[model samples]
Target: MVESFHEFVVHRSPALCRTAYLLTGDHQLAEDLVQTALARTYRHWRRVRDGNPEAYVRRVMYHQQVSWWRRRRLVERLEAELTERADTDHSEATTLRLSLDAALRQLTPRQRAVIVLRYYEDLTEAQVADALGCTLGTVKRHGHDGLRRLRAVAPELVDATAERSTR
Candidate 1:
């Protein structure tokens, strides 16, 4: 157990921030999420000190994010104006990365959360289920459906050789 809130924040902020960023897909939102989670954790620090404080904070973040999604009526419109730059190396990897990002955006929040928890965070299905407060079957279903959607939407990222050979 962390002895102090300052120590806890100093030790766990980076990992928490990374998870927040993955969950929200926006740096500002990620930072805000982390701060909000940490604040909640601090309020309940004495209570959670005996248990897994980090897990408590992570749960708060996930629930808070889902709550935000529930309250959001308007779809976010992101318009980035990129200035033209000199020719830069654009490889197949870059193309695949962009495609994967776009495909991920198409998924429902629950499915995207499952993907991030299972793959990006390298958590097991059971662990993910616990983290997301769902059942093992639910996690498996989401993961399966999420992967299926990714394969359909971004087949090149899913199977590089198969795609390249067909081209």
Candidate 2:
């Protein structure tokens, strides 16, 4: 463990930034997410120092993100980072990645977080539930609902490959 909270933040911020980016999609929002989570972690540094401080910080980020989304639902959707990148080749993979990102933004915050945690983070359903401080059934429902919403918005994002992998 790091000797101080500042040391811990300096060491882990980059990774936390990446996780925040995955959770929020937008780069700026990802930075804000990391800042806020770290702030809370700092506040309880003494208590968390002996345990899994990183997990504590991550849980704070997820809950704070959902709360922020709920409060901001009435505001206009911002897409500062949605513009196409010129560097990427116009391949099917590029288009699919872009489509998936856009489609992810359409779901409710809880559903979006559920999808990121379950699929992108490769966390099992029960682990996701634990991380989100929710019940197993809640995680299952959110995963199901998120997938259903994605199918309606971007069917290409879901395919028989996942089904075959399971079945």
TM-score of each: 0.80, 0.78
Worst 10 residues of 1 by lDDT: 76-85
Candidate 2 versus truth, CA RMSD in Å, comes to 4.3
Candidate 2 regions exceeding 4 Å error are 1-4, 74-89, 159-167
For model 2, residues 27-127, the per-residue Cα lDDT tens digits are 89999999999888888898998887877887899999888877777543445344667875777665666677788888888898889878877878977
The lDDT values for all models are 0.81, 0.81
Identify the runs in model 1 with alpha carbons over 4 angstroms from their true place.
Answer: 1-3, 76-94, 160-167
Task: Score residue 131 of candidate 1 by CA lDDT.
Answer: 80
Candidate 1 versus truth, CA RMSD in Å, comes to 4.1
What are the per-residue Cα lDDT tens digits for candidate 1 across 18-120?
Answer: 8887778788989999999988888889898778777788778989888887898457533322235679656677666556567776678889889988898
Scored against the true structure, residue 125 in model 1 reaches a CA lDDT of: 91
